[model samples]
Target: MCVYVVDDDPRICRLLARLVGLEGFEVHTFEKAAMFLENLTRLKFGHVILDIDMPEHNGLDVLDHILHQKPYWPVIIISGSTAMDDAITAFRRGAIHFLRKPFRRDDLRAVLSEARKVGVKRIAAYELQARVMQVKLTGRETQVLDAMAGGLQSKMIAWKLGLSIRTVDMHRSNILAKLSARNSSQAVAIARGLGLTQ
Candidate 1:
């Protein structure tokens, strides 16, 4: 598998490339988001190790762009700061993990393992998408499901979609039932696999 490491610091990029390369994976390092985006089309399949703080465009913006193009893409956000808000926001933005800088090698390994599992899940989701489209969801339910896949809470979804909280809750329930998902996260996963997020 290939791994794309995006960080402003060349030293950090080299460290990650070396560490990941040692694992028998092809590693590519980028010092800027534009460079990364330029080369992204060449990377058919891979996990991204993205640093959150970068000049020109922040990590979140990059992440947003990536997800817009590929919702099921596996991205792990890394930063020097341990801000809880940032971590939460990353998760809400569909990051697999938010790792702090200077992380232990074992931690990196663990995160990579988790990302691999997510990759597997994404493949399965793609397969399931074909079947999922058979289920009929109303326009609003589809909209709500799309929002849920974006990691938005019911309240936020309601506000964004200009619906009542009760309506959002109802749509969430219907979406979960239709998708056979136990919760919002699973529903979102299924939605992502179905290519419904874009």
Candidate 2:
């Protein structure tokens, strides 16, 4: 499951994300409501925790905009306000829950768990459509690549594959030479673009 937090306060955003992450949800933090909204269509966050008091855009306004774009997006609104009117306004504006500021970890965890239960159906379906790109390699070189992908050094790969380290290095050189990659990260990215890890 994924969780998104949008707050003008970067510290709060980071803290909340870390808390959610501890609950086993993948977390993404955005300092501005506008930036998060820009990626709303392309990004599928399981649950969104929004701050109502952001400088540029109010949380309810952002939520309304998101709903206008995608009616059923799940969200929770957070605020320091204790006014019943604010909570009512949040619900009327389509917030899933109203979380007061300085919420307890257990409460957040429970909310996140509930969000995942609801969001997993969609996340699972999307995961099937998602692809992880891997590097290109021949049958033999693929073995080498997979090992390297695991962070095994050349000597370790060679030992695992019953080959000399020099042989492994030669294969690595050939692989890099063919792919025109400056390093492993670049190679992995290029391979992804070409759809190698389907």
Candidate 3:
């Protein structure tokens, strides 16, 4: 599994990269929270080692954004702060682990090992859900369902897709049937749960 180390301290980043690399995992280091957040969408799925104390966009903010967009990715908080409140906040925000600075290498390795196992399971679940959607919905039906999830009515979807309103409605009906949903709203909810629609 890939591991991303985000810290403003160059020394800490280098130490983490070296340690994680020795464990046979790919490592990427970012010196700024903004830089990491800007490239978040383009980066592949991986575990994150984040520092809570940063100039702007602290680790908690980044953690929230990651959970909001990619809840499956594991985040490990590494901070020099001794405040118990920081640890509490990190756990509350869904961090997988918390490590203090000057921590043992063995501790870091253990956390990464655990994160990798959980990451594999979550990724497999996502892929399975995606395959189920692919098997159940036609290409056009998926498009229509995505549009519905985006709060577009059949008329708007029809105009955007250059299809008749009747055709769009038909696709919506098919989506509902294939997903075993009672209504368009239910279909959208199912699609979202399956991670089929953004």
Worst 10 residues of 3 by lDDT: 128-137
Per-residue alpha-carbon lDDT of candidate 2 for residues 1-198, written as tens digits (9 for 90 to 100): 678898999889989988988887789999989899899889865578999988799778898987777555577888988888878998898877888988998888877776666566655544433433233368777677667667789989999999999999888776676567788666556555554532
Better of 2 and 3 by TM-score: 3
Candidate 3 contains a number of clashing pairs equal to 0
Predicted model with the maximum lDDT: 3
Q: What is the full ranking by TM-score, best candidate first? A: 3, 1, 2
Better of 1 and 2 by lDDT: 1
**What lDDT score is found at residue 168 in candidate 3?**
98
Candidate 3 similarity to native, TM-score: 0.67
Across residues 63-152, which tens digit of lDDT does each residue of candidate 1 receive?
988887777779999999878998999999989998998899889998898888898798677657757668788999989987877778
TM-score of each candidate structure, all chains considered together: 0.64, 0.59, 0.67
Question: Which residue pairs clash within candidate 1?
Answer: none
Q: TM-score of predicted model 2?
A: 0.59
Q: Which 10-residue span in candidate 1 carries the lowest summed lDDT?
A: 124-133
